[model samples]
Target: MAHPSFSLSRRLRLSLVSLSLLACGAAWAQQAPSSATAPAPTPSGHMLAEIQVIPRPAGTADDRYKHVDAAIAVIQASGLRYEVHGLGTVVEGPPEKVWPLLQAVHQATLEAGAERTLSIIKVSSGAQAGGPRVEDLVRKFRN
Candidate 1:
C-alpha cells in the first residue's frame, strides 16, 4: 500500500501535466492555418506580432540570459524585420513566415536545455484599422 501523501502528489502531477498538454494544443490551434493553401496577405503584405518566450529551468537560480540570447539568435537569422524590446520581441512579416519563426524561437529555448517553455504571443493583421509598426510604435513617444 502507498502513503496517502504520495498518492495525492501523483494525482496533482498528473493534473498539471494534463493541463499543460491542453494548453499546448490550444496554442497550436491558434497558429494553425485555416485552409490547406497559404493564407492571403493583408494590403500591406505583412502582419505584426509580439512574442515573449519564457523558459523556466526546473532547478536552481542561474543565468538564463544565455537561453534568451540563443532564442534571439534564431530570430536574427530568420531575416524578418524585428525589434527586441525589454519584455518581448516584436516581429513583422507575412503570417506564413512569422508563425514558423516563432515556433523556431520556442524550440531553440528548449534545445538550450529549458525544462519547460511558455510563449506569450499577440498578433495583429496589417489590414486592421490601426495596425502596429515597430518604428511607429517605438518612436512615437521618444524624445
Candidate 2:
C-alpha cells in the first residue's frame, strides 16, 4: 500500500497536468487553422491588445527610454495596426498575428540592453463582423 502523503501528492500532480492540458486545448482551439492547407483565418473581426513593456536597465532614465523606443520600432515594423498611448501601445489584428508581434516586441526590449523586463497585456476579442476598433470606442466620448 502507498503512503497517504504520497497518494495525495500523486493526485495533485495528476490534477495539475489535466488542468494544463485543458488550458492548452482551449488556446489552440481559438487560433486553430480552419483547414490543413490554408493558414489560420485572420478572423473577419478585429481583436484589440494593449501591451506595456517596462524595462529595468542598469544605466540612467535615458536607457529605459531607449528600450521603449526599440520596442516601438518592432511594433512599427510588425505591420499590424497600432496606436501609441502615453503608457502603452494598442495593437489591432487577429490573435494569430498580434500574439507573435507582441512576443517580438518583448524580445526587442531585452535585446536593447534591458536586464529585466515586465510586460503587461490586455486583450479584448469581439464576435461582431467588424470587431471593435480603437477609433470607434473613443469617438463616442470625444467632443
Candidate 1 lDDT over 1-143, as tens digits, reads: 76775577554432222122223235444553447644434335567777776665422247536566777889899999887765667788878899999899888888887778777777767454333355434332346
Candidate 1: Cα lDDT at 20: 25
Error of 1 at 69 (Å): 1.2
Model 2 Cα displacement at 139 (Å)?
A: 1.3
Question: Number of clashes in every candidate structure?
Answer: 0, 0
What is candidate 2's lDDT per residue for 31-123, written digit by digit as tens? Answer: 433354443344575687887777665224655377878888898998888887756788888788998988998888889888887777777
What is the lDDT of every predicted structure here? 0.63, 0.66
C-alpha positional error of residue 80 in candidate 1 after TM-score superposition, expressed in Å: 0.8
TM-scores, each model vs. reference? 0.61, 0.63
Error of 2 at 3 (Å): 44
